[model samples]
Target: MRTLVIGDIHGGYKALLQVLERANVTKEDTLIFLGDYVDGWSQSAETIQYLIELSEKQQCIFIKGNHDVWCHEWLLNPEIENHIWFRNGGKETITSYLTNNFDTIAHLEFYKTLKNYYVDKKNRLFIHAGFSSMKGPANEVYLTNYRWDRTLWEMAIVMDKRVKKHSSLYPNRLKLYSEIYIGHTPTLHYDTDVPMQGINVWNIDTGAAFTGKLTILDIDTKEFWQSDPLPNLYPDEKGRN
Candidate 1:
């Protein structure tokens, strides 16, 4: 059974469908979504619903992204008011729900069930964002900080650089995992014909919410597949839904 690790969908349902169709994913294949399943497009509700259906038919792992966290926060406490969420394509998500008259309850339930990370015995780690290496109980710190702490992302990048440089021989560093798949940072030249290799940290977020393609990486083979023709939902800078 092949495992396909997908990146931040960000409500690009059309792009997502195209990628899945191109990949010809089967029910036996395990799909690990790297999160940001909602917000930043016209079809947030539809995208979440599709994921829920996909999970029922296959081994699916969903991790929480910062945008997903914002969605949860908006659901639980809409009164709290998050300007950043509104500015960052969340306005469209809100409008979609409102247009459907809060029809996203089931989709919201799907997001609520997601975990922050998944690890396999084969040394494959999947997370929505970066992890923390705070020398405490390893899993505890990694999970808590990776999902909820932005500060940890900054620190993890620094630590990741150091780890990449010096941890080739150290089993302690290597023992953590052989490879990690993540999203959140969007590659500007995502659809360019550039070949990427070397580090096993595969970042598949093609930034579909921002005129980019959707991406999927086959974890075992490290073969990347992406949707053709980048989407352009947000054409203006006014942040209008």
Candidate 2:
């Protein structure tokens, strides 16, 4: 069974479908979505519905992104004003549900069930974002940092490869996992639109929320697939601009 790790979707349902189709995911495969499933594009509601259906048919693991958490709060109380969310693609998500008149209970349930992080038997860590504390993935670290921190990735980007010396200075950060997978910081930030590898961390967020594509990688083989550039797919709309 193939283990596929997908990056942030950000309401690009067409991109999401294309990436899934390109990967040829099967029932036996395990799909790990790194969150931000909603917001950005005009199809956030459709994206959530598709994921809910997909989960019933496969082994799907969902990680809660900051956007997902904000969306959850809004779903529970639509009247709440969150300028940050609304400005950063939340308006589109709201329009989708309002236009479609969807019963969002199922979607809410899915969001509520999402995990902050996941660690497989191989000791590979999957999280929406990284942690702030130098401490590795543990219960003691602040949970919110798991979905908001960027320093962890930044540190890994310039880490020393000498295991012994590095482990001595950053024991908590170094000794925990065999590899890490994260998706909150888009690869576009580095002026690239593909998955990036830094030391032992793999960043799969190719910026589907903006002009980049959605990416999916096989955890074991490191093989990957990407959707077409999102701007091309949604030619008429401005995505999170």
Candidate 3:
């Protein structure tokens, strides 16, 4: 029973599928998606549908990302204007929905149903972004505050940075239950730095939407697998023209 922790998909369904095939994931394997499942790429709708089906077939845990929350808000109440989604690859997601003529209500409900954070039986934590407050170690953070509170988000960022610096100096400052798995911040490497724990909090977002590799981490062995690089779906102004 291998537990696979996947980073942000960001609508790169092709890359995701390739990674899954490479991993040879099965029903016995639990998949924890760290959020940002949609947006950025052109296949947002397709990605969501794939995830929906995957969730039904396997042991899957879907966490809400900042982009997911934005999409939910816009889909449920578009009249109530918000820029968070639009600024962060929301336009691509909206375009995908409109192009596919998807049922808005159904999609919105799916997004609403997603959990903001997840804690495993081993007490390992997973979130889209960083946590608000972690009590003992990376795994014992308050899920509610980590997911929904704005103040906690601000403090978490600060603490995370501090921990990252300290961890480098004192390699074994603390060891919580297991470790926290997160996405949202794309990194060139599979395991980036976090305060206090050095590489305690693993970041798997390999920036697939930016034509980068898609990453998946094997929970038991802590091994990482990646898909072949793809073209950036949403290139910068220089590449757009």
- What digit string (tens of lDDT, one per residue) describes model 1 on residues 1-241? 8989887877777778988988989999999998888787677767877888888899999988888888877776767778898888788877766666544577668767888788877867777766656332245544555655443333333444435445564323334667766677665444533123324455666666566668888887778788754444334322222
- Give the lDDT of residue 94 in candidate 3: 78
Residue-by-residue lDDT tens digits, candidate 2, 1-241: 9999999999999999999999998899999999999899999999999999999998999999999998999999999999999999999999988888666889889988999899999999999998765566575358888789888789877777665534556546645788899999999999999899877889999999999999999999999999999999999999986
The digit string of per-residue lDDT tens for model 3 on 66-148 reads 77777777777767666666666777777787788666666776797898777788878777766443343244356544434
CA lDDT scores, all candidates in order? 0.69, 0.90, 0.67
Best by lDDT: 2
RMSD of each: 4.1, 1.6, 5.6
**How far out, in Å, is residue 237 in model 1?**
10
Q: Clash totals for all models, in order? A: 0, 0, 5
Question: Candidate 1, residue 7: CA error in Å?
Answer: 0.8
Model 1: how far is 200 from its true place, Å? 3.1
Instruction: List runs of model 2 lying over 4 Å from the truth.
Output: 162-171
> What ranges in model 1 sit over 4 Å off?
101-104, 134-144, 148-175, 189-198, 232-241
State model 1's lDDT: 0.69
Q: lDDT of model 2 at residue 101?
A: 62
